[model samples]
Target: MTWKKLDQIRRENPVTDEEEYGQAYAEASLAFELARLVYGLRTQAGLTQTELARRMGTTQSSVARWESGGSLPTIDLLDRLGRAVDVRLELVASHHDPTSSKDSPSCAVAFGAR
Candidate 1:
């Protein structure tokens, strides 16, 4: 058995069926992005997980889960997190034309210091 790089493996067997994997890929990407955002917010606020959880009225385990991307936070939870971190949270939705070359419709979360 020989070692093969991930890029080499991907090049050998590319994803030919976007329909089968697009949704999963998008969901994973969003989860990763959200995890980074949560971790960033907590760190920037100089708060430990326990402190952040206390401020949000949630458990430290829940904060860990969010930071790990193991769970997706609800809108209400996001609002609480924003308040806990002293940041303004904005959720934006927009439609994208399927016929266009652009990607599908998606939502975004913007954060600003309060």
Candidate 2:
């Protein structure tokens, strides 16, 4: 579909009709993305939800909830997941200055090996 058409549809969507709905929609989108990522990684590793939960020292239900987009994982839990799945997790931060044209400072925190 064309960008214009997509934008029009988005504008007409009920989720965007109000401020609270917009916020909830945004949150749900993030949750879905996170769920997809977690589920994909677990599948790629040939691990079941229970197995992944055991690796993460969490419960199967917790893993199921996360994979179902019913809950969000904490940063520490994300780090643990990265290690359990042999992946790297990084938290990057950039400080932008409106007055300055130069690039802003940034920080990155990585979990697991390269």
In order of appearance, the predictions have TM-scores of: 0.73, 0.70
Which TM-score value belongs to model 1? 0.73
Q: For candidate 1, give the lDDT of residue 38.
A: 92
Clashing pairs in 2: none
Clashes of 2: 0
Error of 1 at 107 (Å): 9.4
Alpha-carbon local distance difference test for all models: 0.86, 0.84
Candidate 2 lDDT score relative to the true structure: 0.84
Candidate 2 structure quality by residue, lDDT tens digits, 20-86: 9878889999899889978987898899999999999999999899999999988888888888888
Model 1 lDDT tens row, 35-109:
998999999999999999999999999999989999888888888889998899888676756675443337776
Best by lDDT: 1
Candidate 1, 111: how far from true, in Å?
9.3
Q: Which prediction has the highest TM-score against the true structure?
A: 1
